[model samples]
Target: MTKFADIKGFVFDLDGVITDTSVLHGTAWHQLADYLGVAWSKELADGLKGISRMDSLEMILKAGGKENDYTPEQKVELAAKKNTNYVAEVDKMTPANILPGMKAFLDDIRDKGYLLSLASASKNAPRVLAKLELTDYFPEIVDPASLKHGKPDPEIYTKGAQLLNLDPAQCVGLEDAAAGVQAINAAGETSLGIGDATELGAADMVFADTSLVTLANIEKHMA
Candidate 1:
């Protein structure tokens, strides 16, 4: 097995990697769609996976054929409403909501002395981390609000590497979305994607799910 000798840090995306808050986000969006008389579908929910909040809202609005119906202020208000719903559900999340094998993986990463930080597009990332009781492992979370660009842009991953005081090349980024894998690659970091291998082809390595994300497994499989 090839060891990841040069890797010093791991930058993680929150929603799908740490927990499944995307369901809450989709539910919130669905509620907003209901308010706008728009039909919700799985494809629309899937499309929102790794993008910024405003971008997700824009996609939903366009899908509803109501993109032009609201002023900028009204759109912001609508997004806030959706956030309210998402927050209500996320606040209910406990460590039990952490994905399978993820807690052990986190403990292993921590014990092994790798630097850790977060690069999630979600503004609620801090809250979710706190809810999961995993904040001690990640003190630096790249602020989504401060970023000028979102996933597929590399800015968030680049900033996350900066937070760890490490070069992007010395870090490995973990994500569950195609856009996120692209961002990590563009940032010059090795991407470890957790999800469908075909969909996350940009990743340097792909695991079927969080349960398979062990470090030993990664070194065994990653090139």
Candidate 2:
């Protein structure tokens, strides 16, 4: 039997995994931080990865010692502003923006008969996939609006497995952030992190980048 014999589905995180829209997200957040008179840093931007819009906003506010400055209503407006900026950038993406080897990896997984689903914190996931013309590859995308918790909570990853009609243990969750990897592991899925190994040490496996995320590589590591 293959090393992934029991795995029936693959759950993917958007942003850094399927495409390079992370910079777009960062730009949007930076714009919002500027509007709020908050100083932004690369470290703060890094912490926002794999987290929800509200969560990211909250973190940014706290980093600037302005967490209590905005009322709940103002926070909502700020988040909407950020999303508006993000969607504007996302609108410019094309299929060519799909990460190296990611398109081929999706094709290969589908050809091999494994189900595919997405578990993204971004509300613009559908738009992003559509922009990249990769919607058909993922039959299910767990709705971020339906979840009560975000990454590092396991709610999203667990919902992803349910959407694929599989148990968490029977699925492989791919992510490029520490929070996402932690969420996948908490959900009982085999976690594959697609970035720095040390940063995503919670994952069951780690690939340097999407270009290295081939069936052969996955199986070789699992074996």
All-Cα superposition RMSD per candidate: 2.5, 2.9
Local accuracy of candidate 2 as per-residue lDDT tens digits, 60-84: 9999999999899999999999989
- In candidate 2, position 71 carries an lDDT of 94
How big is the positional error of residue 139 in model 2, measured in Å on the Cα after superposition? 1.4
lDDT of 1 by residue, 86-198 (tens): 99989999999999999999999889999999998777889999999999989899988899987799999999999999999889899998988999999999899999999
Give lDDT for model 2.
0.91
TM-score of each predicted structure versus truth: 0.87, 0.84
Query: Which lDDT values do the candidates have, in the order given?
Result: 0.89, 0.91
lDDT, candidate 1, equals 0.89
